[model samples]
Target: MTCTIFYTTAMPNDRAQVSGTAPRKPMRWAVEYLIKTPDGRTLVESTKTIQRATFEELRAIMDHIIGAIGDEAGNIASFVSWRATARGGRSKRRARR
Candidate 1:
């Protein structure tokens, strides 16, 4: 299986401005996920937007992606991510295992 991820920053109050006593919050992150089989068969392709994604929410998404891929040869089970710098460039140092 092959997986690709892309993330972007969300606009402030892009959806709406509601009148309420509670604080107003807008989604801050949007992530796009694509999963495909080795044979080029698409499994899952979706985008998730959240105001603040909790650990459990992220974990569940990972579990779902993994379950869809299944455990098979030539599948990627581990992933690493690098934080971009303020200039929109990758970190100076690479991620270490």
Candidate 2:
């Protein structure tokens, strides 16, 4: 399954939750990606939403938008999003599993 992530306008309720996570530092997120929980319903970090999505659909969005979006970032860290390593992340588990 693939996941697609996109930026959305920060909602009123979103502000409080986001702030709580990375307190004492300025926070900025361009988008939000929603994923379903194991129970088969939609969840937004713990907040449930009626919107539902399939993995393939989200994957397409990531490829088209996110995969090519950032590199020389003007806003955040290298790890905030997934990145394809030039030579792989030098993994031990990757060799085993």
Candidate 3:
């Protein structure tokens, strides 16, 4: 199996800022975890949406995924949506595995 990590910075609500109230800080981050088979079919996904996550919380999520999926979790295929960035090293890691 392969693990894919999708994460982005949380955005503050606009309404709070427009209402002249202090905008509540959103969780520092948001993330989705997915596991896929070698043939490109999704196996399982996180049921709970992580819209607000601290760095520690994200790490905990990663740990859980790793425990569930084994060492394959260490070879993550990460994509950063905000920056339109994708890691090029995923193929190398997959090859190693």
Candidate 4:
């Protein structure tokens, strides 16, 4: 199994900016992870928007996710989408077992 992670910054629209306030950092950051089989079929996709934060912190989180996927590559099909977990989908123990 192979996994790819994609992420980008989301800028706020003019309406979100205050006339007098300093420009806000990006409205949020969008992150996505795509889990695929060796042949290139997408098995699962997860996306999330996180509030602005320090680069180190964000990088740490991204590293953690990538590490996790690598650790679980052998059983990738049993992995659940991160988005689904946020929405109260199957728990990790149940998903794997």
Best candidate, TM-score-wise? 4
lDDT per model vs. reference = 0.36, 0.29, 0.36, 0.41
Write down the RMSD of candidate 3 (Cα, Å): 19.6
TM-score of 2: 0.22
Per-residue CA lDDT of model 1 for 1-97, tens digit only, reads 1112222223253222222122122212344444554466554433444345332244355455455555642565333121111112133587889
Colliding pairs, model 1: none
**CA displacement after TM-score superposition, residue 89 of candidate 2 (Å):** 40
Give the per-residue lDDT of model 4 (tens digit) for 1-97.
1112223222233111112222223223346565554545564544566665333355566557656775777644322233111111222355554
Clashes of each: 0, 2, 0, 0
Error of 4 at 35 (Å): 3.3
Candidate 3 lDDT, tens digit per residue, 1-97? 1223433323343111111222133243323444544445444443444455443355565556545563554444332121111111222245544
Ordered by lDDT, highest first, the candidates read 4, 3, 1, 2
Top candidate, metric lDDT = 4
Cα deviation at 44, candidate 3, in Å, is 4.3
Worst 10 residues of 4 by lDDT: 14-23
Q: How do the predictions measure up, each by TM-score?
A: 0.29, 0.22, 0.29, 0.36
Residue 91 miss distance in model 3 (angstroms)? 41
Q: List candidate 1 segments past 4 Å from native.
A: 1-29, 50-52, 55-57, 65-97
Model 4: CA > 4 A from native: 1-28, 39-41, 75-97
**What's model 3's lDDT at 32?**
41
Candidate 2 stretches greater than 4 Å from native? 1-53, 71-77, 81-97
Superposed on all Cα atoms, the candidates' RMSDs to the truth, in angstroms, are 17.1, 16.9, 19.6, 16.5
Over 21-50, each residue of candidate 2 has an lDDT whose tens digit, in order, gives 121222122234443323444423322221
